[model samples]
Target: MSGVGGDDEHIWRLAVQKDGKIVAAGHVATAAGGEDFAVARYLPDGRLDRSFNSSGSLPGTVVTDIEGGRDQLRDITLGTRGRIVAAGSATLPAVRGGTSFTVARYLRDGSLDPSFGSGEPRPGVVVTPMAANDDLDLAESVVIDRHDRILAGGSADADGRFDLALARYRPDGSLDRRFGDAGKVLANVGPGSTDEDLAGLALQPDGRILAGGSTAATEFAVDGDFLLARFRDDGTLDRGFGRGGFVITRTAPGEADDEIFDIALQMPNRLVAAGECDQPATGRDVCLARYLVSP
Candidate 1:
């Protein structure tokens, strides 16, 4: 509804609680010219929920500075016991314009859960550096599993190229080594030089993970294709799915960009993806695609 900080605020994701309360999260511009993760809870009627963050300067709002730099929440999900988990990217000021996958967990009262992340970076915040060379990595989507484990999907720099990246964290916020290579997995949907990013993530009924986004042929390609990748519970590619666990679809015939910003699982054997596809004649148009879950 209204601005939370009076300054510039951008809401990129929203989640509704089982009790009908709505949670909005994004980034708020700080007076210092930096940004901080901002979250606010509102009742179904659009009124601020005073019950949240009541002790803060702004009722029903919580602002977190993960690394004292730029922080934003691109996706929000409800966790076990009504906890809120948000995922996005945080700038690492020490890395010279580098960013990393950032996640923060909050209790029902909008208080940071100190029991979550290791205090190396910040309390109640988990900062994951996808590359050792300090590259830009971001988590655009987040989902919590039945076991309360957290899964974040986005893009990670792979040797100066962007690839679809996924990371799983245990309930305690520690990297789940049982997942990919130390709780992280990166998939190259196109050529090694292509940039692939995952903006949507969904868990199938059987716990399989599905991520969808876009892949650009070049670093500055004006046109791109929709990209989807499936992974087993253990984080390995689902070979039984699309070609080698990846599917690339060009929504339009020629030079047009088709990006999937979100995905949903539709029962027995289908998944639906929605985003925008650029049309040469007419600006960008809404696009939707359905895929069979099987090979």
Candidate 2:
């Protein structure tokens, strides 16, 4: 599907339906402009979904935005009722804003859902910039809880500093006030002179939440480390896990940068964290680490 509209495509994350169907998501070029989130559904036989958004979506039903700026979908998962939920950042073209953490929901039929967002930027999109006036709010991961609540985590910038941010939303697409102050919590995971960027998130069987990513300084600095933390269901840090609810480990002692881009639960209390690390011999090596659940 390459065309003059800059058909460059990069798929970041995807989900498989219970029926064996697959849905791939990422950002697609915009002719001579920026990129908008591109989502494609495929049949089990590896055929494109010809019945999805046939004529209403655009560019072969690959677009999901309303009618403004460019957006990106970094992580995605299947929600209840077979809804497709994606998360990333958006450059609000309507307000000419820089970028804000965004979450969008789509029906199983590949059309935008009308229950998300507050009707500002659109109807099916959820735009949460942390402050709406902040510099940037970007989401790196998204997941659905046992109760079907939507949870997204990343970094939120304020005072020129970045902090770990996690927000919980009800199935109806409304903020769950019972959560961290209206369904949002921001934690300063970097104690030193650095910022923490949450890249991965996992839900424990006990309803607790686990997050993994990187913590380091910006501005051409190369001394970053991997960060992992555990949180209770109420959004509070799990003090029993690590030193003050978080742990920072480095894959490379004093080399470039290291981070846990993704994490998964092995059983009850065990977790597997995987990402790229700077290796002294091979330059970049695939790093994997295992952690006890109680730790």
Candidate 3:
């Protein structure tokens, strides 16, 4: 669909409401050459749901400028009471590795939820810097737990290297101190890996968490492997699962690159991951892998 001024738009995630309305979150280019977080709602018939953001300039869409900089929502999850939680990264031009993990909650009508992040730097928005030095931090996947807590997963820079990172937030947009250290957890799937990024997140029936992404083998490696990590409710690694709570898989033969961009849990005891793998003859090929969840 057309975005703000029909500028370049990139949708990163979509969710269907209980009533069959489709909600999409992404980023739209701005006149200043920056990007803004954009959300739109559509009816089941593929028509814009003008019922959303009715009073706003755009009938069915809401565009937010988190910091007057580059703000994009890479993932969105529908929470209880029709609340929408979106997560991604916010970047400022002046700071080194300026990106920070950003999350915003919106009401069903596409307006910012004033109850969240009300007293923070910005109302209805939460920006988390994973590193003290302003290193790059991004939240690519988001999920709401049974308790209504929000969980965002992506990558955090760790001394120049990237590690799979997860952050949990309370309903009020405050970091849940009960989760991981200070509400944040970082996992390095492969030792010596230069980059480890989480692109998908899932919650198990038992309250555990699953994260899937990719890990590059070396500093300048062109090849990567699918990486998976499981964690307990409190955010510690689930040692009983894959080797030390992490799994690395090479989807293709030889020194090909493989990365998992999304993951889903099967009913009983299986997990499926989908992404892309470098194929020797066909360049890049879609790849899917199923794993048996350890009892």
Superposed model 3: Cα runs more than 4 Å off: 93-97, 219-221
**Superior candidate under TM-score, 1 versus 2:** 1
Ranking by lDDT: 3, 1, 2
Residues 82-190 of candidate 3: C-alpha lDDT, one tens digit per residue: 9899999999655544799999999988889999988887789988887657788888999998899999999888888888899999999999999999899988866
**Alpha-carbon RMSD of each model:** 1.8, 2.5, 1.8
Model 3: lowest-lDDT 10 consecutive positions:
215-224
Off by over 4 Å in 1: 95-97, 118-121
Which ten residues in a row are the worst by lDDT in model 2? 57-66
TM-score of 2: 0.90
Residue pairs with clashing backbones, model 1: none
State the C-alpha lDDT per candidate.
0.86, 0.78, 0.87
Work out the TM-score per prediction: 0.95, 0.90, 0.95
TM for candidate 1 is: 0.95
lDDT accuracy of residue 231 in candidate 2: 91
